[model samples]
Target: MAIRGALRELSVQLSLLNRQVGARLELKDVDLDCLDLINAHGPLTPSALARRTGLHPATMTGILDRLERGGWISRDRDPSDRRAVRISTRRDRNAELLGLFAGMNTSLEHICAGYEDADLELVADFLGRAAEAGRIAAESLTAE
Candidate 1:
């Protein structure tokens, strides 16, 4: 219950931050999330993206279209498989997008600097487990 409460607070804060970033970039929440995915672990195929995001094909299409139209991302054919299309962010604006969260990232880094190495490792493990749990929950919801 305690961890759940903490995660709930974190989610609220992240959503608020996401909303602010989205408004500043003239993007919807899902669009921003797509960008985050691309920036984090993307250059992913459309099908992979849809599965990762748990978005329907049609809805993912709209988000991709909007992001592409806004010049935030680009699509390309996978070199190994020409038939497969992969999505990536526009390199020119990559720095600008990352800049949005630079302050928060820096602050988090500064906070981490105070933690002992073992404590930091524990925190990282906890976060990893929590994220996996989130993924599992999302998958279960989608499966239903």
Candidate 2:
């Protein structure tokens, strides 16, 4: 119960943070999700992205279309499978994206600076485990 409450609180806080940051930067949730997905999984097909993001394939198409139109991502013929296309982040924006991520990390680190090393480690471990559990839960929900 405590963990669930904590996760809910964290989700709320993160959503608020995202909205604030997004307002300043003009980023939409889909744009951020697409960037995050590509950053974590490298190049992927639209179907693969849909699976990873738990979005409908048609929804993924719209997301990809918007990102492509914005020049944040590009698609190319998959080297190993000419019949399939893969989407990836644009090379020119790599540094800019990395900088933005680093800045967010720094902000988070500063917010966590009051914690002791062991406390921080424990929190990190818990969050990692919880993330994996959440992913499983999401997959199961989608399956149903």
lDDT of each: 0.92, 0.82
State the lDDT of candidate 1 residue by residue for 63-126, as single tens digits.
9999999999999999999999999988898777778889889999999999999999998999
> Per-residue lDDT for 52-133 in model 2, tens only?
8788998888888888887789999998989999999887976766665686689888979989999999999989998999
Model 1: lDDT to the true structure: 0.92
| lDDT top scorer | 1
The weakest ten consecutive residues by lDDT in model 2 span 17-26
Candidate closest to the true structure, highest TM-score: 1
TM-score, each model? 0.93, 0.81
Candidate 2 ranges beyond 4 A from true positions? 1-3, 24-26, 94-103, 111-118
